[model samples]
Target: MEFLAVVMLAVFTAGYLVLAGADIGVGMLLPWLGRDQDERRLVIASFAPFFLGNEVWLVSAAGIVAGAFPGLEHTLIEGLYPLVVMLLAGWVMRDMGLWLRGRVDAPRWRGWCDGAIVAGSWALALAWASVLGSLLVSAMSGGTGLNAGTVLGLPLAALFAWHGAGFARWRLPEDLAARAARVPVRYAVSGAVLVAVAVAAGSGLSWSDAAAEGSALSMTAVTTAAVLPLLMAAQGLVWWTFRGRVESPSYL
Candidate 1:
């Protein structure tokens, strides 16, 4: 039952990470990708359908963590309280930016909304990475502060940017799409390499250690090792299958 619960938690985490990463990436890239007000609206429209849905995954992941691993939750809340607060604040700002950016009439207000979106998204990403870093380090070393885990934020954010760019390329028109696709390839390559290195180095413990015992961390490591490749493959296939500009006149 614990194994099953952990597996479910991983699934929820992946869902939230991938979907929200892309959603946040769009916001992060908006200033650079969009040349004008109309272009910006198009970028926003492309992600509107999935924005709220993506966030649902996050809520689900949190619930799973709180319910299934209360000890872990307590540790995280205790160690990374400030980051948790920032993450919530970032989410609120990003959500408000999404909603109000469209409703307000002034160009200045739209700019402010755009700024909020970018800032909020980056803050959420950094906070998440830092928290995860704190969790991993604390678990392994009995340490109570940030370490290499905190540095994972950059690559993780880049990964999200890559996912967002791929999404934008698939959904947006011509020049915008091409531009989006070009930038993310670099980010994708760098993010993947850096993230892999970070995870491997930070964990310190070997695969054999994880397999030797049946503890929660061990099961998580084993499950992650087994499932991550499959998930990446699935994500690759999905991207390949959907790779191309949509012919629709409207964003769905």
Candidate 2:
């Protein structure tokens, strides 16, 4: 029963990662999305279409956390004080940016809101990735597993910021894409390393555990083998296909 529930929760978590993750990636790259005023307008419009609905997964995830695992809620939230705060704060900032973009009058003023949206979205991405990385790197030991209990800290967050930079690569105007890409490319490299380390840790845990209970490790390996390369290739193709094109988001 517990196992089934956890597995379901993990699946839900993955769904959130794919959808909301892309949404964040889009925002992080927004400032770079266009070369000229028209392109930038299109970039902004790309977000405008689906901005509000993209976060439904988040709400669903929270409901699952609060309702499904009520017992773990207090402990999880209390122990991860800073992370929870940042998560909510980032959410607020990003959402506020979306709202304020509409209400504000001037183009220059709204541009500031767009900046906030990008910063908040990417900041949230880094924070989330770091916590997940810490979870992977923490020492996994015997009876209580207190070592694994703590979330991954700054190093992982830095890694996330790095990969997020990679996601920025294609989002900008053709000219800026290469320039803005330097940071995200580095970020992606670091994030890839962190994810690799996490995989290694899981493999080690699977080998050492007496009862062979590391289903999480098994699933992670299977998913990584199946998914990561495909995503890399797909993203590359996307970049190649759209290389010099302006933001005609009608195709999106």
Candidate 3:
């Protein structure tokens, strides 16, 4: 029974990682993908359509955590007020940026709205990475949420930002898309490597539970389910996108 519970929680975590990671990535990457007016607008269009769907996992996971593993929720989220606040703020800004950017008439106003998206993306990625660091270390010792805004967290944010940039680069006008195609491949590879290491660390953490012998395989299978599609998509993008050539008339 306990084993099933652990497996479910692990699955939830994996789901959240891939979906929410892309959400945050969209926010972070959008800022740099557009070099000018029309290009930025195209970049925004690239992600605005699908980003909302990413929230389903977060909503479902929250319900599961609150209902099934209520105790573990307390263990993890306790004293983590700042991260929650940061997360909420980011979500709001990103969404607002998505909506308002389109509505605004002035280019400058639209840019500000887009900038909000960048901030939201930046914030979300950092918060997630900080949480990962806490999970890895089993402690949020540096004043809990207050210090989640650390240098380490920033790198995670940078990665997400880069990820967002890739989305923008690919989705935007041909000239900008060409530039972005070059970057997404590298960022996707790095994000995958980060996940691989985290999976290794998680496997190492499970070493003490000799009785629960199946956890290693369970974790491996669950994680592979979440990441393999992403890996394949990235590989395909690299193979298909020749010399950063933007495929126009749209066949993504």
Best by TM-score: 1
Please provide, for model 1 over 71-134, each residue's C-alpha lDDT reduced to its tens digit, 9 standing for 90 to 100. Answer: 5565556656778898899999988888888786789998888888888987887776676655
CA error at residue 238 for candidate 3, angstroms: 22
Question: Per-model C-alpha lDDT, please?
Answer: 0.66, 0.53, 0.56
For model 1, give the 10-residue run with minimal summed lDDT: 205-214
Query: In model 3, which runs have C-alpha deviations exceeding 4 angstroms?
Result: 139-151, 165-174, 184-191, 197-252
Would you list the rank order by TM-score, best first? 1, 3, 2
Off by over 4 Å in 2: 35-38, 139-252
- How large an RMSD does model 2 have? 7.8
What C-alpha lDDT does candidate 1 achieve relative to the native structure?
0.66
